[model samples]
Target chain A: EDQVTQSPEALRLQEGESSSLNCSYTVSGLRGLFWYRQDPGKGPEFLFTLYSAGEEKEKERLKATLTKKESFLHITAPKPEDSATYLCAVPFTSGTYKYIFGTGTRLKVLA
Target chain B: DVKVTQSSRYLVKRTGEKVFLECVQDMDHENMFWYRQDPGLGLRLIYFSYDVKMKEKGDIPEGYSVSREKKERFSLILESASTNQTSMYLCASTQVNQPQHFGDGTRLSIL
Candidate 1:
């Protein structure tokens, strides 16, 4: 079965503190990985997509890196505005549109 | 910008009643998806549509049905609403092989 697991269910960091969130997967064929940020009372916002091993993408203070079996979302100098639930997902199959999502990591940035 | 619009931000329906959640995307995307997000279960796909009148069941499609009579609009219907179906329902749309864009989500409560 294809599954995605995210570590550190919750995290607290001071403003400007940097950290990385892990998303490990066990699937037959890796097609792509997606990162999203969801705020309270809102749906998730698209962050990045990594397609292959050693692939990386960045936007503002967030960076996403992908490997053969896992992906990482690294936050740099995160602000209170950046405090949200980070979710990672992978396609259920090589060419299918269905996605398997992780439980997400809730991060709180203290001012 | 891809705009995915869900019909309601919050909804309340009685148990055993029929419920409908609507979603529309303006980006002309070919794929539209419906998912429910819970505290620990993450996002579970309920159904999806690849084209007008073409629907596919997702991992958790039982007790729910979907309609996509138009290319940009998809609707999820619950035959009989249950307490377990009360969740944050999200709708998303995207082109093939592209990152999905999501709506603001509809928080549905069953009484």
Candidate 2:
């Protein structure tokens, strides 16, 4: 079965701290991976999409990198406003549009 | 910007009552999706539509049905509301092979 797992269910970082969140997957064929940031009581906001190994995308202080079996979301100089739940997702199959999502990593950046 | 709008941010319904959650996307995207998010479970697909009057069952479509009368709108209906169905319902839309854009979400509570 296709599954996505995110490590470190929760994390606390000092302002400007740098860290990476892991998203490992087990699936037949890798099509694409997505990253999202969701604040409490709000919907998820799209972050990035990585399509292949060695592929990377960045926005502001966030960077997403993809590999054969996993993806990483690296945060640089994170501020308190950057605190949110980071979620990773992969398509359920190569042909389908459905997605399998991870449990997400709750990140809190302290000032 | 792609704007996905959900009808409500919070809702309350009694058990055995029918419930409906609505979503609309401003961008002329061909694909729209509905998902329920819960603690530890992440986002589980409920239903999706590729075009007007077309629908597809998702991973967790039981006890729920969907309607897509128009290209920009998609509705999710619960046959009979249950406590287990209380969750944060999110709606998203995307173009083919593109990352999905999400709404602000609707938090539904069953009593």
Off by over 4 Å in 2: none
- DockQ of candidate 1 is 0.79
> TM-score of chain B only, all predictions?
0.98, 0.98
Q: What is the lDDT of residue B32 in candidate 2?
A: 95
Interface RMSD of each: 1.2, 1.3
- Candidates' TM-scores? 0.94, 0.94
**Over the stretch A1-111, how does candidate 2's per-residue lDDT look in tens digits?**
899999889999999999999999998878778999999999989899998899999999999999999999999999999999999887777677777789999999999
DockQ winner among the candidates? 1
In Å, residue B94's CA in model 1 sits off its true spot by 1.7
- lDDT assessment of candidate 2: 0.92
Measured against the true two-chain complex, the DockQ scores of the candidates, in the order shown, are 0.79, 0.73
TM-score for candidate 1, residues paired by index: 0.94
Candidate 2 chain B worst ten-residue window by lDDT: B92-101
